[model samples]
Target: MKNKPQYAIESVDHALHLATLLQQEGPLRVSEAADRLGVSRSTAHRLLSMLVYRDFAEQGGDRRYQAGPVLRAAGTSGAPVALLRRVALPHMQQLVARVRETANLMVRVDASVRFVASVESDQVLRVGDRVGRVLPAHLASGGKALLAALPPHELAELYPDPEAAGVNLPKLRRELGLVRKRGFAINDQLTETGLTALGMVIPEPDGRPFAALSIAMPAVRFDRDLLSTWVSALSTAVTATDRDLAAAPVLGQSRGS
Candidate 1:
């Protein structure tokens, strides 16, 4: 085996070590962190404060520190969602190759949708890579698919006042209804002018959709005649990805922790 590097960044390493402790042991006290890391109380306080600001740690009612939302999310890092992304990659590539369009896998985060994986079309005039880009859920095809899949109560929570400032509640409801009936979502120049995209939701084990697979292509090359074909291909790809995710080992579980 190759030798490990001798040099390491002390502060970054310390922060990560603290995060690991939180993940393994749940809540932690400043003194505990300090003793375990062999650092000063002041250093531990500063480190924990940084975690709080970054959403990885939180102060509880008793003023002790506990894992926050970000930390909990980290604990489940072996989450199936990561497997979903990995299994979806080949399907995304196949979708791009077959449909001559950019393919993406996306998930909703609060009011926005984030593209986690993408396969760009080979054509020079194709859409660019969408990975790491976030956009309004109401405007993207993938976002609409996931939003449509939400339960009524959850939907209400997500958009308490659709008519609230800068929002058009009625139109969004209508679009979501259409998505439910059609089993897919379509974006026609909504996110980007002259671009059209179609998306299909991928359901989790609980039957709630947390992600979607989508294809984006230029409007100039779009045709009503090929929509059915594109939808079929995309749906097949999404289904295969979902199945693989189910069969694959859970992220952390597979690592023999």
Candidate 2:
């Protein structure tokens, strides 16, 4: 008797599920992937092998799998920053034009702030920072704006070691209090000597902050009145940018999609 050939294979739903798992609880082992996906170890291995071959994921030294640079590049091609650049560039440019100070968009990652986009001010004493730079979240205006938005319990979780150098919970709480009261935060020579910055948070529709918009200038350039004006301008820019992002079809759908 002739035996029939088996041709069953995994579906796209399985692949998408595996991809989502890798995206969420990343750096998975074959056993871990199998358990999460409810598949056999060999099947998980085969799926991961295909994903690696396609550059969807990479295996690390510890034999765990994580999303590869290809996936990262693809995901960030139209990232929030990119969307912001398209939707909020004019507002950022306008802020820079009016204030003649460097305007930047930043997002918090762990205990640091990552500059996602920037537009340099047209002033002679410009600060000249760019995107992808990480700064201590405790020091920068944008960092404070982000930190001020986090829930107190989450903030405590983020800064667990109070005895560690540069970790001052009391000071941070005080700064955050001021930030919440004033609707903006300030960095006076905290990031770089002689530089000052003012920042405001860009809240989502639910009023949760996902990013910060800031303007950096020379400390000497801003007096108390000028600082107040800059803060107002920064707040305006953030509000306009938030509205623009809210109205953007691509960003609105992409976030939920």
Candidate 3:
């Protein structure tokens, strides 16, 4: 051991340290935390429980711990969505650079999805910035990726009256089923007249997805032969953002922003 900082509360330090790890690494097991902090497994469990109670951390279905809503609220910005935009921007930029196509980050909003951040490609014919755009969740690649994660009942709730919503329930179900099978979504001129997009959900530690990352390009430039390559690059970008969400330091705050 190098040295223990003087005047630091050991338990609090441990908790903060664990939070940092989760923010940077995505999720952590008790054993992992214990090893990292040089503490007993029981001690790590207690520290994590404290974080969970305070909403700074959340326990996922996999029994791993990750950054929670409190961290989003405590981030150095306004709301959780704003913080999400900030957290996902760098990854989006990198994705755009790699694919030479505009990359978008979006979140589900009831029956629709809202674009929070977009990085435009340098190509002259690339899709333009889509930030602030909203489209039906079933119509856009990013939106569909998020919607596809919802339970069947939830989708039913959203489209109880398909005619009023101008959506075909059976078709949407088929599309979502395909997304589930493939672990991603594709939009072939469903949203924009001549655009194509491929999207994958960015999962939270608990397995719930709060956002999706997508590549939007002109339909003419879309190559079916390169679909696998595009999906691989897009998935890598989402993974990077997920890691950032885990590593962000957002603790000790009340809900004002």
Candidate 4:
């Protein structure tokens, strides 16, 4: 192993160390990164911010950081994510056009959902691109849809210690039940105060939920009367995207953006 040089720059060392940790550990919260780096939370945040600016890291909706495009591009695991993002973009764009609302694609990673791809709407007050954002699987619309696809045993395992995890198991179960019945999920001001989202799961060839698609708009623009129209359009886009994903040879394994 190489020894640290006497003249090494501390800030640069911390940033590079954080990048390595992100690539190896998947995602990290500011607190976690701070503790690992033996630095203040603010210092960790600044370092992570710098990494994000250079595309070496990305911030999630929950404020966690993960490996960004530059690092991802240098690794083998990025193949599926890159391909998934690429394959899903055209469909996301079409979905945006259909509803004039922002569209997002996300994949579940443990208890969190990562926004892998997002297409913004043309509206003046639309939800922005959420790519590289992470959110709780129980709170986000797309996440709930993916969660609803989990087998009972798997979901039960997800909340083995609900209280410790700050999860309301019963409430989540009811919401997931509704998602299963409706074939979609409605995150009505749940993820954010003024945002409403409708989400559906994109399937793997084996019919398991691989990822999810969502339409997000300002709550002010949402009307109950538009529910059917939104769902119909989302369903069409989901079907088309699903068909294309199934036909892609590079996507032989389950992948997410």
Give the candidate number with the greatest TM-score: 4
Q: Which runs in model 3 stand beyond 4 Å of their true positions?
A: 1-79, 251-257
TM-score for candidate 2, residues paired by index: 0.68
Which portions of model 4 miss their true places by more than 4 Å? 1-79, 253-257
The TM-scores of all predictions, comma-separated, are: 0.67, 0.68, 0.66, 0.70
lDDT of 4 by residue, 1-257 (tens): 11245598999888877886686457899999999789999999999999999999998888789989987864222224545667888988988998999999888878878777778899877787676566888988999999999988899898899998778998899989999999999988977888899999987766577889999998999999999999999999899888887778767544442
Model 1 residue 171 CA deviation (Å) reads: 2.5
The number of clashing residue pairs in model 2 is: 0
All-Cα superposition RMSD per candidate: 10.5, 15.3, 14.9, 11.9
Which window of 10 residues has the lowest lDDT sum in candidate 2? 1-10
Output the better candidate (2/3) by lDDT: 3
Lowest lDDT block of 10, candidate 1: 74-83
Residues 78-152, candidate 1: write the lDDT tens digits: 224445667889888888888889898887877678677778888877887665466888888999999898877
Model 2: residues with Cα > 4 Å off, grouped in runs: 1-79, 254-257
Candidate 1 residue runs with Cα over 4 Å from true position: 1-81, 251-257
- Residue 110 in model 4: shift from native, Å? 0.4
Better of 1 and 3 by lDDT: 3
Query: Cα deviation in Å at residue 141, candidate 3?
Result: 0.2
